[model samples]
Target chain A: MLKTSLSKLTIFILTGFLMVFFIGMSIVFGYTNTSIQLAYEAFTQFNESNEHLIIRTVRLPRALIAAACGASLAITGVLMQTLTKNPLASPGILGINAGAGFAVVLSITIFHISSLQAFAWISFLGAGLAAICVYVISSAGTGGLTPMKITLAGSAISAMFSSLTQGILVTNEAGFEQVLFWLAGSVQGRKLELLAAVSPYLFIGWTAALMIAPRMNVLAMGDDVAVGLGLKLGRIKIFTGIIVILLAGSSVAAAGPIGFIGIIIPHIAKKIIGLDHRWLIPYSALLGASLLLAADIAARYIIMPREVPVGVMTALIGTPFFIYIARKGLSQS
Target chain B: MSKYYSFRILADKISFLIDKKAMIKIGFLALLTLLIFIISAGLGGMPINPLHVLQVFFGGGEDMERLVVMQFRLPRIMVSIFAGMALAVAGGILQGMVRNPLASPDIIGITAGAGAAVVAFLFLFSDHNHSLTVSIKWMPAAAFIGAAIVGFSVYFLSWRNGVTPVRLVLVGIGIAALMQACTTLLMVTGPIYRAAEANIWITGSVSGSSWEKVQILAPWTIILLIIAFLSTRTINVQELGDEVAIGLGSSVERQRFFLLLISTCLVGGAVAFAGGIGFVGLMAPHMARRLVGSSFDALLPTSAFIGAVLVMLADLIGRTAFGPLEVPAGVFTAAIGAPYFIYLLVKTK
Candidate 1:
């Protein structure tokens, strides 16, 4: 009874508590001195003042977008890892984020799509191409897609895309100012309506993720075991791959390619709830949302007056964690 | 008995080279590299006649031609060759020591660590440099100290009982990512002008390289390459695992220490001058192995030559590809080399 009582529900409740607390903190903490009272009043009052406007427009949307992108990327990571059966997999590491970013840049430069939705539509194409490139290139030759090959291929593709992106930026510093925050993976000062543009795809991706979570459990049990249990490996892989692109692309569109959340959150969630995807998925979502909110809040105070990009903050936190895991897992293998 | 002795002597000569075929391949690559070098030096956005390029090189051309070839192009070309040699030798030592193809300085966090340190110095000390020469000279030292610190820390971190290749590579990757973020954060968060300066360095350009920088880099390259060459036998022995190396009377730990030191210094010096130019370290050694085969003695020079050739070509492309608007040499190296690396991954087991 005691063991059962310490269930995933309790974990969910704890995560929820953390999320609400951080969201509240995110809303209240920023350059403009906004009290919790102003946060409540922003929802209640019909005031047209600058302070209330700042609270309603700036902090609120920034916090929400950060959380939304965090959740989207974390879920994407979980799905990618499940599909590939490689613990080291994630959108950032696998070139999906870079791909999405490249597409957004190319569209802005060449097509001059100057609105919110272009990020979503164009990046989706770029993200898909990048993923296919990594997958096809790694799967070639005799060894047939080992973890080592995938990692090497992903990094190489990522390097190429990132180099190209920098080339474009350097050639025309005109685009630099507009995309600086986006390139650095900040949610600050982004147009809030862009959130509305990307939300639908994220929602679809999330729903797809949940639907396949149970199937993912059997798939994790190696290919032969999954086949013995009557799972359609091909269909499952294709579905998971699509969800990964959607979620990863949307996050890149909405925010820049905020990394490590996707890679780290799934690991954190799994530790709390084990490998049961039904439990893991929600835990990952909650933790990711809360963590990014916390990171955003910290980003505000780190170098006061001017804030670092939340991406940098997350990288600082996530890098040590990654190193720890890499040290442990790779050494044992 | 005499016949048997002569046969053994003949076999010893064959084994000295490992393969005649590989030696011929090395010679072919060397010739190809010389041809490319001459072509690159002669032609650019401002074209010089190839015969006149030789004249300009030997101090006999017209004033404008001399200015373009000697004062500008020659130094840039020399830095590319030196930087490439340094990086390739460093990488060759690392890969040979680790027995893993993925163990380049770039992959293993050494370049990023050194780069981050250089950024930190610029952000902290640019105001106090007092002169341009002082500011320029301090960069390599700062970068060297940074690489040493990072290299030592990474070495110690991976040294739990003994270092394993996988653990080292993994930890290196994680640390490399972290250092890059630190670098970017420093660049992004600083004032715009400093940020631009840091950004150019981070991308690995040798633009505006002068005779002074070539002087600084050349000696380091020559000395380090020589040291690296002498350690080939030890590195080859170290590749056969610790127990086997011990059985062969090699002090595995001491040799490994020296090899790591040599690689770190070579890489540190190169990055200090070139601003973390990458893929040469990783790409050149792999190409050498396939082209010249892997007898460490022959392999060292072959890899160094390949690295020099690759970077010279890359720098040539970077300067000329878009005319006055230059792409950084590092960008060209990565853009071209990354695909080939993937192809290598496909080809290799």
Candidate 2:
């Protein structure tokens, strides 16, 4: 583990560099296959050629959305793990993503609203409602939110929302075509303006996550220990909860309900750096951004001309890691 | 009045006590299930009267009525009811063996595994004309194999010394996500028509169920239900927690494996015919518990009847409620089951 702050900072900067490199890879490669020179020219010199337009409009926004959503989801994962004290807890597993996706689909099919801003607010409302429902349901019993209880509660809620979403899609075929890729969780075809709508919430979530990293360290050391140390447990939890909703909700709004990045990146960060949230949070963001950018790039190539959604790519990658963690037992966290 | 009725045979070599109140509740549920079956059968596109459904049953109806009732309605009704019964029984076994109220077949990935397999089967077997190259009759077999494969994998993967309930559940969740991902991947890559067809199946419908499906699923489900019913004692013992059950000289792991197998087979048979009918397993058992306490013998039968009723009603509403759209029964079940699930979570203490 990196004991010295200098070493942690060095590695953190290195990861940020790696993230930038992957972002570049994401931009340069796709179905159209632009070069670094072409990508550079697209930004520096505006000639509206087919490749340049694809580079400037299509590739860059997708890359940014993937990076931002990945980072947000990963930070959300760190906060969720700390808040629930469950290693397996993430927005997707806990139904926040499904809830947000469900809200978007519901509005699309029912109200026919396609506005990006509407998606942002609707997803936040959905994510917040699901989070509260899960918390309330799991906390209702005697033990007050055991990991098992919360996991079950979350999975149940996730199933409910997804099934309901399927119901709507089954009934409305046109809406089905419109929302299928989004529901499958992709960072493709999203415009910069789409990212622009939810970035402010994403910014607040990132800033708040970094700010609370120290208290999260205390909170991670068991509830009794944190209480003995005079942290206002309830307020901190609510604060973290809002941040989670903001981060997870906005990302789902932007790129559908991408799975597994949140759960996978936090653990990867914890493994590289120790459990210190201060370093872990930033490291996780970089790793998450890099991993998703890499996945998004790979997603383009996996199915030839047809792109498999990046969400499916991450799920394909993440399930094995998830099973390994599960097999290692819950106490390993 | 005594609450217990004891049945004995072969000089007390076999004896079991039945709860009178539970028996009464089961009887009532069975009647309710019959009512739903008849109502659903009678109220489809033709809308035969419920009284005329019984008349058709006794071979007294016209040819068109026979075609609609005998050829069309009965098979789908039977499929849904039997599938529902199988799912509820499987779910009851799971909740008991896992010692968790929230445990169900879908939550643990059985239904999803079957769904992925079915979708993959459709995608793989279809020719350039978008029709199956092989007989679609083999889809159930594919679904069964898929559910068994995933069920055993979850059990074996969670096996560290022995499979703890928490580990099994966690592993199952991971596997479930993977299966869902697979389903989505296949759907997206396939034609949009295929995606729509698969979506209807994934959301689960009994619309196209034929007598052939009923014939296969009925015997499979009935045999599993009987086996499940006979194993109620083992499930009851396991429900007391693993340590206690082991202390009582029960082969806890072996019994758990046995119970898990039964649940998987039941779920496989159900999913094979009905597709991924969500939440019937979860909802039925809990509703049964409310009706007839927590005893396995009472709970199992009660849950089966309630499940049959629930799915039959869901199918009923699906076909009848939405004007010509024909929503899948799984949708209605989720509509009711999700809220009830939240309530169960809240009341889980």
Candidate 3:
């Protein structure tokens, strides 16, 4: 771990540079190849060419969305793991993604709402509701929410939401076709307006995550220690919960509930930067952005002309790491 | 001795001891399963009389009644009942083997593996005409292969000194997510019509049940169930924990593997026939434990009955409740099972 401030700063700066490079890679590489020169011209020169239009309209928003979603999801993972005190906690694992996906499908099916603005809010509502349900269920039992209880509760709730989504889709075949890709999760072919819709919420999530980093460091010492340190445990928890919903919800809204980035990035960030949230949070953001951009880039090439969802790519990468951690045992910090 | 009844045959070479109360409870549950079977068979689009359904079962009903009861509804109902029983038994075996209340085939990735296999089967076998190039008979084998591959991998991967329950579950979860990703990738890349078909299968439904599927799944499930029941003594000892089982001269690791194999086979059969019917494996065994206590001999059968009832009821509700649109049985199971699971989580000490 990078202990000295100078080394940490240097690594952080390097990661940020890496993020920029990945974003550029994401933009330049796809089924339709656009050179860096063309990408540059698309940004700088006023050309109404097809490649320019594709670069400007299609690839730019997708890269931006992937980066934003990845960073937001990773931060959400860090907050959730800390909040639940569970190494396995993440929006995807906790039924938040299924919830958001269900809500999106429900809105499309029942209300027939196809507008971009409606999609983002519905996703937030669903994610918040799921997070609340998992919390309430896990906390209600005798032991007051151990990591195991929360994990089980989250998975159970995910099963419920996903089955409900299936029920709706089974009944409405048209809706099945409509949201199938979305449910698998992708940053492909997404409109900039969708990102525009959720960007403010994502921005707030990032800022608040950074602001709350110091308090989280104390909270990591255990609830009793934080309480003895004069922290308002209830208020901080509620604040943390809201930030998680904001970050996770908007990311899901932007990228359709991409999985594993949140779980993978925070752990990787901690390994490189150590456990101090002050450095850890920003470092995770950069690393997460780079990871998703890289995954998105890979998603394009894995099947060639037809793209596999980046969600699948992340799972392919994340499962091995997940298994390693699991085999390493959960007791380690 | 008064609480148990002992039976002997062949000069005590073969003997059985059964708890009288557990027997009574099992009998009552068996009756309840029958009642549910009749009700589910009687309440579809073209409703049949319960008496006529019973009569049709014994070959004494009008041709229309026989067609509706035997041809249309019987296979579907049988599929659900047996699928439920297999899943419940599998869940019971897993919970006992792991000594964790939350352990079940679905939670561990057996079902997900089966789901991925089924989708892959469809994706690979379909020719340009979109019809399966291979016989549909082979699909169940594919699902079984998938579940077995995952189940054994989870077991082998968790093996360091021996397979600890924690590592098994953790590895299972990891593999389950991977299987889910693979399933989704296959579904998304396939044609929309095929995607819908695969979706229904993944969610788990008996909507496409036929006699041939019943023939395959029924025998497979029953054999596994019997094997599971006979191994109850080992599980009961195994549940006492590794040290005690070892102390009792039980080969703990080997028996654990045997039991895991049984549950894996049971799950393989269940998912092969019913698709990925979600929460029955978790819910049924739990409810059975509540009904019959934790003794494996009584617990396994009770779980089977309860599971049969739950899925039969879920299937009934899925097809009948929505009117015109047939929903998959897996959805109703989750709708009920998830809340009950929350209640279990809350109510457990």
Candidate 4:
């Protein structure tokens, strides 16, 4: 047992080390003329030179957005799985991303609203509305919010919102570019101001999620047992719903609908640390951030001078791993 | 006088049998569908007068009116019907196979595969000037190949000693995520123009569909429909679970493989023609099951008809509701079908 625990600890440390190494690599690599050594110097000295501007202003912000977006999405996934007690539950599953995308599309096309701050607020509102809608729809019948029911309701809502967004785009030629970019789920051209704007909400969401980890543990045991243990099931559900909206909304606002990170990362973390949410949440956050940052780094260099959306890279890497975990989980269950 | 009394008695018996609860409900739904279809066909922009449409159908209209009705509107209508029917059949087969109402073509990675393949084509070939011949011949082939890859991957990955529905679904989701990721990568890195074109296609559209597309799709759709029909017996037996199916002398593995292959073909063919239209494959089977009973034999036909009707109505709305600037048929179907699907989900259990 001691040897096994020690080996697990070793793996954890290695993952942590890999995360830091990748972040450094992301800072060093770029599409421009600057060599790796020069890039390092520019990064460390806060150089105001042209090369420094390209590295610090352009590449760094993009990488940071990727990391932050990825980590938040993965954490949201962990919360969703725990709260809904369904392995398939993710932020995308609940239509939050679609709602946010629709709101952004409306702002751009119909309302002619262009400010990033306004877009963020609109996305948050849309996400909140979508979650409430899912909750109400799923809880309507007698068996009150079974995992399967919520999954179905979420898919239906997602379909509806995404269709509406697509309808608007197809009908109006002006909104096409905006919709296309948003739909691709990129982390390019983001500003630190945008990141700062979304940070408070992310912090509050993360804190709330951590605080509820113990309750989630009990909740996972089954609703009746959790209720018997004096947990208010309704309150917990509402709280988690809000947290999902905040996390998912802010992430979407910052960097479009980067998906699969939220769906795949938590499953990976769970395999490493078992079902305990305390470890799962933190581990998923770190791992998700690391994974996204690495993918973003690859995105920049893969097609030099052109970038792939970080979302796509994550999907490629995360999907195979996700498939493996799901298969394993199914067999054991 | 006694003979007249016997005739009245016979009439009463016939009425009583027709007015039984199940029959009345089915009749009502059928009537409602007809009403929707008629209204939809008449409501589109550049409206062909209902009378003119009828006259054209009967070979009595002016050439100009007949051309408009037959060449443009008729093909659009036919494509929508074919797409809807194919998707619904695929959904019914999948849901029955999985024993999960949520199982749809998209959920199983077929849609994602098609989407990814289209994006790859746009990226790799957008720069070439050989437009007409290349697009007509190669586009559908690309979609088919992509869909086959994803479907086969999901099936193989999910198969251990034997395939299970739950494992299949889970693996499909994983493969879908991967395919989506590849799609995004292509969109982001490829030329902006190509990405834009691919994006529009991915959301789905039946706007520019021609007779050629219809011809390409019809044979596969008919063949797959027959396959779905034949598999219904095995599907019903499998619903009793694998142990019982085996005991009853059914080759569960072979049956499942064939059914999945047929479903993949249906989805791939429809998507090749119409892009990744959402919701019909997911919602049609559930609605059909509710209308008829769960027997796959009955459910498949009902779902196909309902699916076709839904797509036709959606196409009509897509063309007419906004006027001139048409929404894709895909968007319309999702808007209409998703809410109803949600209602079903909430009400069923």
DockQ leader: 2
lDDT of 1 by residue, B61-153 (tens): 899988888888888888888888889988889888877665688877898898899888888775634223345678888888888888877
Each candidate structure's count of clashing pairs: 0, 0, 0, 0
DockQ of each: 0.44, 0.80, 0.61, 0.50
Give Cα distance to truth, residue A197, candidate 3, Å. Answer: 1.0
Candidate 2 residue spans exceeding 4 A from truth: A331-333, B8-15, B347-349
Instruction: Provide the lDDT at A29 for model 2.
Output: 91
**Model 4 over residues A196-287: C-alpha lDDT tens digits?**
88888889988998898888899889889999999999899889888888889999898887777887788778778777777678778888
Per-residue C-alpha lDDT of model 3 across residues A234-268, encoded as one tens digit per residue: 99999999999888889888888788898898899
Q: Model 4: what TM-score for its first chain?
A: 0.89
Better of 1 and 4 by lDDT: 1
Lowest summed lDDT window (length 10), candidate 4 chain A: A1-10
Candidate scoring better on lDDT of 1 and 2 = 2
RMSD vs true structure, all candidates: 3.7, 1.4, 2.3, 5.6
lDDT of model 1 at position B60: 93
Where is model 3 chain A poorest over a 10-residue stretch in terms of lDDT? Answer: A324-333
For each prediction in turn, the share of the native Cα contacts (below 8 Å between chains A and B) that it retains comes to 0.41, 0.86, 0.70, 0.62
Give TM-scores for every candidate, taking all chains together and pairing residue i with residue i: 0.91, 0.98, 0.95, 0.87
Quote model 2's TM-score. 0.98
Ranking by TM-score: 2, 3, 1, 4
TM-score of chain B of each: 0.90, 0.96, 0.95, 0.87
* Cα lDDT tens digits for candidate 3, B1-349: 4988777667964445668898999999999999989988889899888988889989899998888888889899999999999999999999998887778898789999999999999999999889999998888899999999999999998887888777787788788889999998998998887889998888898888899989988998998888887778788888999899999998888988999999999999989989999888888888888877888888999999999999899899999998988889988888788778767865765
Q: What's the DockQ of model 2? A: 0.80
* lDDT, model 2: 0.92
